[model samples]
Target chain A: MNSPLITRFIFLFVFLSLINAQDKNGYFSLENRLKFGNFLFCKGDYIRAIDEYNFVLTKQNNDTLKFKIALAYQKLERYDESENSFKELFTSQQFGSEAKFEYFKTLYLSDKFETMHKRIADDSFIESSISDKLKRLYNLKHLYSSKSIEDSSKFFQPFNQNESIELLKFYVRKQNLDNKSPALAAVLSAIIPGLGKVYTENYGDGITAFLLTGVLTFLAIDNFNADHNFRGWLFTTLAAYFYAGNIYGSAASAVLFNANVRMNFDSDLTLFLNKNNHFSSNSNLFCK
Target chain B: MKKYIYILILFFCSVSFSNDELARQYEYADKLFNDQNYFEAITEFKRLSFFDEKNVYAYESNYKIGIAYKYGGFYDNSVFYLSHAIRTTENIDERIQAEFQIVRCNILRKTTDRALQLLSQMEKDSVYSNHQNEIHYWKGWSYMISDRWDSAAESFANISDDHELKILSEQVSNDKYSVTFARVISYILPGAGQFYTGNYLSGLMSLAWNVLWGYLTINSFIENRAFDGVAIGSLLWLRFYRGNIQNAEKLAVQKNIEIANTALLYLMENYRGEKP
Candidate 1:
């Protein structure tokens, strides 16, 4: 009887120890997974971090984890998923305003300036704390979009004095872009062998065209004077080919020059926005 | 007697749950790595490193992470993690393994100088003196990737006279056209460079065009039309001459590419050996 009792007690004690071990190392427990997910998030491994965070979501709802998942989606450049995730937090007491700000930012980053502008203008869910900053972002978005902007006074009101001065240069460059006209370039080259290329700022090509056409025309005249009819006609034909090709080339060069100017202005505007933190006071809002 | 029996029973029961958390984590990470889920595997390995407070899994974790990065095409990151493994491991074999992995990564990254530098350093170290064959092997790879066929041949010849890579390198060195020679010969004779590079048709066309234009230019000057001579000489004769030189240089480069490509294709298909 005593032996059986001792055996029963030992089995119970061993079972309790196993339970304790499980408790100590619940590797996939919600708390442990959350901790691991946070580690991955901090390390910029957003994809796997989202996996771990979503794993925890299967067990329970957590606002902080949801916000992190949205931020991770944003970092991964999955704009649709990021927008949807942020939309889910729009009514949350803690992250509602922050979600609104980040959602608009995602819209801007995704190049949906029209949508961002419309949402900022019409959405009643805007928070007072971020209202000025959002409006400033709205003004900045105008620089990137093809949409016409408001007057300089209204636009400058959103930025500080120093920023206004710098942005004014970009704004003026945007307004006074030296876009060449292809038709004008063609006519100029037709009137003068290479003037259209000169108008398009291709000085070397212009000079070459002028020299080649001038030399070929002189050869045609010289051959004709010497009674070399075949040679004269050959030079005339070559000169005609070069002259017509130059006219067409000048037109094409004008179009390319305009494209280059637009590209440079867009790039400069983008760089300025990036260098100035996109004129956002809350650039680091949710990142911290 | 009952007390001793009770103790034995408890010991047996406890032993069933003896695997700790860190060990289980290590096994899980190893499973991920073996399954080739490197993106997730890196995370799991990092998790193990984080929880392993006593640094027990430092060497293994870094090594696995480095290998994972290598497979992922992140050679710089692979070198970084392998360097960590080298620092943490006390074993000479493990150190050599990590160091060679760094060399392999550098080779694949096309940083041949760093790879050669590290390999030579290892060759000078007494601990790696016995690994000269392996060093020479990777050195050959570095030279091969840098397109230094002669150096590659010499490096692989250090391993054995009949080494396959050595043979391939030597074949490439002999069969490839010399760009400078082609250019100089074309400068001397209108299409000789093209003939040397085996572009017979281009060579003949170049020679014909140059001769026709040259005769026209000289005849114009002989006929007392100075302007005609200058126009023909500058516009047609010189253009063909310059084109011949350019074509020769281009053909030589293309021929060498074809030769190197043949060797590369053979290596890819039939060479039964490790590659970078």
Candidate 2:
């Protein structure tokens, strides 16, 4: 009787424990989950952080919490999702300007600069109410999207006198940096052997192109003069092909060189403006 | 007597309470994982591991995290945490499981050398002796992924005589053209290599081009038009001949890759074998 009773007691204990185990919320309360989610967010695991935030968001009406979800998305380079999240606070008045700015940032970071470029110039959107400093900064951003900083006037128009002069000087230095012209390169090579490559500063290739063409042309002429007509014509054809190829290659090199220049200038300008904060308050969102 | 009974009941209740919590958390994490919420499951599993002071769920949670990372395509992280899991557990089976997972990670990340190294090391060890066939199976997968069809077939041949992978790999190897042969033959005969490689149209075009240019040069020379003869011979004929050789070499390599990929794709989709 005693043996049977002890076994029954043990079964009852395990049964009660199993029941508690079946309950979903037996271990971690909702509050503890929120804490763990925040911990994950700080740990740079944005995807998991999103899960936690999404979990807590089910019963919450927190805008800041929502903004964090968007920020986390931005950090993860999921710009599309980030942009959508920022858009939710667009009508909140306090956060609208910041939201719009972040929205633009998402666009910029995603290399959709064309749309951001167009939107900045378009007047139908809410571009007026954002601060004057911010307006100028955005206008400058708009200008940088498509064209190189050819004329500093449009970009400097948004800054104070001192910063305007500083920006002007920066761009003036930028515009003076050596840049190649593909058209001019081709024209030069066409007019004179290897001249276009030399114009593009490819001295070694230019010299090689010159020597190869010169030797082949010389060989062709000598063969023709000596009545070795077949060899002469062969060298002539080769010389002509090389000359034309050199012209085409020089033009392509110049195009690549100019693109590199543009890329460098863009990065330099972005860094300079960011280092100086561009005289605007982009640190805090418009949500305030 | 009543006081002793109360103490016994109180002690049992606390022990069961904690046990219940562990079981609940593990099931919740499992549910999340089964639902395909990998990242969420990772967090839950990680939490369980962190709180399991008795080491009850520590090994399990860490392994789950590794699998989660693998499922998420974070192969490097998978390797990192799986290696950690390897050190945490003393279970021979789980350690081997983690080791295989690491091999999969390396292969998927295109580090075939690392995958092969690991597999070869495991082959030399007595620990994985029981799972030798399984080891060779994954080694074959690694070879198949890298398009080393011959080696893949060799790997599968050890598993069984008529293994499907072995047959598939054999077919891929046989179907592939030797790039060197194509190059050498093209060197000897203009466009002949392309013809041998089943590129009939290109071969015919190349042959016609070479023949036409050859005729032009020869006719010019016979007529004492030396200039025209040399011009046509070097400019058009030589260029076409060189281009034909280049195309033959390139086409042979491309065809081989295409054959390998076809077999790899079929096996990946239709095979009934144990897959990584």
Candidate 3:
């Protein structure tokens, strides 16, 4: 009720009036838009930030903005756009080497391994400034699909001793891997009951197969000795059917085991490489 | 001094007018929501929340966006935005409403424990004393969705005895089969459990298979054919016996599930009750 209260009210009124046109974060100006776009980007709102960046691009051709746009594309999994952006930076003196690495990275991450190898070979033929480490990585990627890589020694030369040793073990494991041939399994089973299952490393099934066929054969012989011709013929037919089924099942099991081995090797190698960041992109100029 | 008073009146009127405009936009967004255009409504509501400087539309917009998301089956997004609205709203009533919607989303997401915890918290709040019935209602709904018919019935029983949901829950609990009983009966007598569940055809077929295999095993042994006896006994008779018991237990459980489903379907289609 006093003059001080009136003075305080006036002060509040003036402050409120001054902020009338401003938003919660203040005026929606150009600089404010850029700040908001970054704020959204940090909040994982890539789609909205892309909209703001698109607007900003209309205003200037800033190198930082271009890099940010490309990074956004990469994060959103628009690999084609990101690759194009990175490729454009390949001729820039400051970002040339870094862009070249990221360009190949895009090809690799997009599962264009064959195309990436071709590009690597073409670049190497031109004496490109690709690093030895990346060359080794590309060589391994090529070896992944190569049927001629029976010896892993030639591939490990570009790597260090520790990596070469690891690669050597991996190569030996892949080469010396036991593969049960289905035809061999089936043939062995036909020769000796349950022998095919044993050949396929299924010892329990092999023993069961031997016991079952042996029991049915004993039943047939016993029935035949008793002059029960019908029962003897029935037992003989059942034993033959079971023997044939076991041979077929053994072949199928062998095929399945080989498939499992190949699948395990592929997934394990992919996971190991991923854990080591062996295929991660590098854009030294932009990322810095 | 008189001029200053008139200027103040004008400023106050303009501020109120802006608020009215914001309310109109909110109505338009709500219309979109009511029309089942949830995706579009979400964008409109987001715009209202983003541009309203007074922040009056923050609670309404965010909460409606959460509801729209729930209707569109974006459960995780619904919960996130609903929780966000609860924090934005200073009004205790609006806060409770948002929390209730979040509990419903949790129910749909099959996270009943979280829904129950949130419901208990809201129920205990003195600010939500008037909202206790609605809270209990959703608690029952959460239990029902989780397939805990007994717990759900108990919750609805806390309300009036003649409540529609109470009757529905009671029916569901009554219709559910005793799984242990089914397994025990099947263990004692193969195919008897399937018979108990009214699967007569399956029960008879299982019984016939067991009897046939048992006769073959015993007959072979009586004929002094040890090899035939052992083979039929171990491989065929024992396998059919095990299969019969398994089939009995499975049929009983399957029947109980069908019973519970019928009650649930009745509640969904015909019962005039408040739902989550």
The per-residue C-alpha lDDT of model 1 at residue A21 equals 53
lDDT pick, better of 2 and 3:
2
Residue lDDT tens for model 3, B1-276: 864774586567556555666677788889999899987687667656766767788888889889988988989989988999988878887887888889989998889999999999888889888887788788888888878888887887777677778887888787776777766787677677778888888878877888887887888789887777777788777888888777777776787778777876877788776655
Candidate 1 per-residue lDDT, tens place, A118-200, comes to: 88777586788777777788778777765456587888886889888988998877767888999999999999999999999
DockQ of all candidates, in order? 0.30, 0.15, 0.19
What would the per-residue lDDT of candidate 2 be over residues B1-276, giving only the tens digit for each residue? 754674478557856787768888899898998898998788888767755667787777877888888889989888988998898889999999999999988888888889999999999999999989988988998998888989999999999979988988888888899998998888887788898899989988988888888887898789776756765677678889899999999889988878877776776788777666
Q: Quote the true-contact fraction of every model.
A: 0.22, 0.11, 0.05
I-RMSD for candidate 3: 6.4
In the range A115-169, model 2's lDDT, one tens digit per residue, is: 7767677665456665454456565564455445655666676678987776775
Query: In model 1, how well does chain A match by TM-score?
Result: 0.84
Taking all chains together, each candidate's TM-score versus the true structure is 0.88, 0.74, 0.74
Q: Tell how far residue B158 is off in model 2, in angstroms.
A: 2.9
- Which residue runs does candidate 3 get wrong by more than 4 Å? A1-37, A51-103, A124-178, A228-238, A279-288, B1-69, B84-95, B117-132, B172-201, B255-276
Question: Of models 1 and 2, which has the larger DockQ?
Answer: 1
Show model 2 residue runs off by greater than 4 Å. A1-28, A80-173, A203-248, A263-288, B1-9, B32-55, B68-74, B212-235
* Model 2 quality (TM-score): 0.74
